[model samples]
Target: MSASETTSRRQVGWGIVLMLGASVCYALMGVSVKIAGRDLPLLTLLLGRSAMLVVASFLLLKFRGSPARPGNPRLILGRSATGFVAMGFYYYAITQIPLANAVTLQFMSPLFVAFFSAKLLGERVGTTLLLCIVLAGIGATLVVAPDLSTFGGDSLFALAAAVLAGVAYVMVRELRKTDTPETIVFNFAVFSLVFSSPAVFLLDRVPTPVEFAALVGTGLFAFGGQILMTYSYRLLEVAFASVFSYSTVLFSALFGFVALGEQPTLLAALGAALIVGTGVIVSVAERVPPAP
Candidate 1:
């Protein structure tokens, strides 16, 4: 392979590693939100999380010497608007549903990303990618096993969150044309604060000391995950990066089992296996040359 090819492969490898770390960070955010207790309103938790994102984003900007303003303001705002709404619904679902189930539902965003990237970015979704996505969808369906018996508002919210998140991620892929990761995150933080603030006014009850700390932890993990994910997308295709995001579902299952005392059903466990298998398939597919 040529030197440029070698460097590109190396960057892609590192991007995958960063995204895996981001998956872990994001999974842990759910644990923190769960621990923060149900008394904290969704918007209030978002307020705290966005506040920390603001602080972390600004510090990152200063450290990197990147400008605070996004080069493409309209795209950044659209990304932020979608992200803010997605996260609001995601947080609400997290508080009401089992962590693993909630995550699996939202994890459907990857399929949407693949679809939209093909349509909007003109990124090719080959036969292999299509098959992998189909397998992943089957796995996700097994994990959720959605039925009237188990379905509720939380499920609806999680699905909405996934769609919005998919849109936001595609916007991120586009914005990376001109925006730094930190600037993208800063704009997201600003818009999250602006959009979630009004709901905070209706929320009652201050967080206890432990709840307060967990809330802060949510933001810290969120910032780390957001920045890592943003950079990962910059290095790799959105659809490709999204394949690795399945790791978040695995991490969420583990966290739910350990922290929340939620045990996965046998079917869910098998589904998790398929999810992991798809990640492995995606990794291998990237490295292997196509048949002549």
Candidate 2:
């Protein structure tokens, strides 16, 4: 095989490993938060998590000596805004929805990313990839559809969270086009901290030693998840990396069952499969070059 082909295969291998590790750790974060909820209020725990992320990301950046790249300040600020909002929904959604379900819907963000990319970045959408998106959306809807009736109040919030995450994912595509990963992550933590501070002031109580430990545990898992995610993105195409990313849902489902006693139904399993399958197809299809 040519060098390029060899590199592509290696990238895929790395992507698989990174996605699996990241996904499992991310699922654990969800489970941890659920456990922490037993004693702490949602807002209080969220603020604590945000604070931890800020500290962890800052130390990470400092350790690596990551310097911010010069870019459009407007775009950076926009991303920073959305990033904070996205995490708001993310934390809230997990609290409301089953861990597996919330995570599965979030993974569908790449479909929105590709769609937005075509609109915002003017990237061409091949027919195959378009179909893949449709399939993925259908799968995601299927997974969450049953909860619509029983989960009325939560349904809207989860949908909103999923949509917000999609927007954040799309924005990241643009941000990465002009910035480094460390820069993006660093700014994400900064803005998340800034945005969460007010809520922290109003909602947070000083955590006990055990409560403090739970916060640290969740933050560490999230930090590892982010690191694995960033490393996967660096190793593989985001499109390709997205396929492996579905592994997060798989992991989350397991964690939900263990942590929250939210066992998967047959339909939910099937839905997860279809959604993740569609994502894989989208990734591989996007790999194909357009016909001249």
Candidate 3:
């Protein structure tokens, strides 16, 4: 009858579907942030988002009054550390790289997820998932294919984001055993505030009405997505949840075209198709027997 127990009892298919919906909403958050324009620095946006998330967490606790604290403050603190590192990298990378390239590379987090799941979660890795990994790498390559001519620095930023995001996600995967979504997200906001303290002086300008809205959206969307994702893990294995996450790519691409006018080339499109196909396969891949 506990929240964790309720989560664990939900059907895997439904959990995944919910996560997918969360992913789609997350992608739209990007679009909304874009609409707010470059006048709002990424750190400022992150800072505002952090404040909103912490408030949201407190409200959730006050409203339910359930025995919701995950009982391990240390675990929550650790997740906060990972969020600090991951969001720092992600916010920086997105600023440096083309949206498409950054998102493509970010998807590579699934590879790290699968590998970590096998080593940390003791899940058996299979050939199907392995191929999926290869395919996702190829897709990421395609996103940066344009840079092959000029060898842009965006690739570096994008890849760094990808790596750090994976590390943060592994932290999330670990935290799930001890913390609830509310705790994890609450910690994220706390860390964001702590991390942004040094840069507070730079935010001398008052955030525009639009910028404020975007920051609020970032908190709400990101928190909601995290909640759905937490519920998702309770239903299925890590790798499945990770791969299902790539649905964000499609929405990202669409948003890029519509909002930022960053159009993808035919090659990029082809590569994304392959990557998406691979992601789907990996998400649904069967757990193969161990090498006998």
All candidates: TM-score: 0.93, 0.82, 0.82
Could you give candidate 1's per-residue lDDT for residues 151-219 as a string of tens digits? 677789989999999999999989987989999999899889887777667766667998999989999
Identify the superior model by TM-score, candidate 1 or candidate 3. 1
lDDT of each: 0.84, 0.66, 0.67
Q: How do the residues 9-102 of candidate 2 rate in per-residue lDDT, one tens digit apiece?
A: 6666666688679888878887777667666766666667777777887787778887755365677778767756766666677777666566
> Which segments of model 1 are wrong by more than 4 Å?
144-149, 287-292
Worst 10 residues of 3 by lDDT: 283-292
Which ten-residue region of model 1 has the weakest summed lDDT? 283-292
Q: Model 1: how far is 213 from its true place, Å?
A: 1.5
Summarize candidate 3's per-residue lDDT along 1-292 as a digit string, tens digits.
Answer: 8875444444655766876887776676666555543676767767766777778877775665623455667766666776576666665556665666566666677778788778877766677767776676776567558745543665565566666666666666666667666666666677778887665787777877877787788777777776676666656666666766776766777778887887777877877787678756654555432111
Query: What is the TM-score of candidate 3?
Result: 0.82
Cα lDDT, model 1, residue 71:
99
True-structure lDDT of candidate 1: 0.84
Q: Note the residue pairs that clash in candidate 1.
A: none
Clashes of 1: 0
The TM-score of candidate 1 is: 0.93
Q: How accurate is candidate 3 locally (lDDT)?
A: 0.67
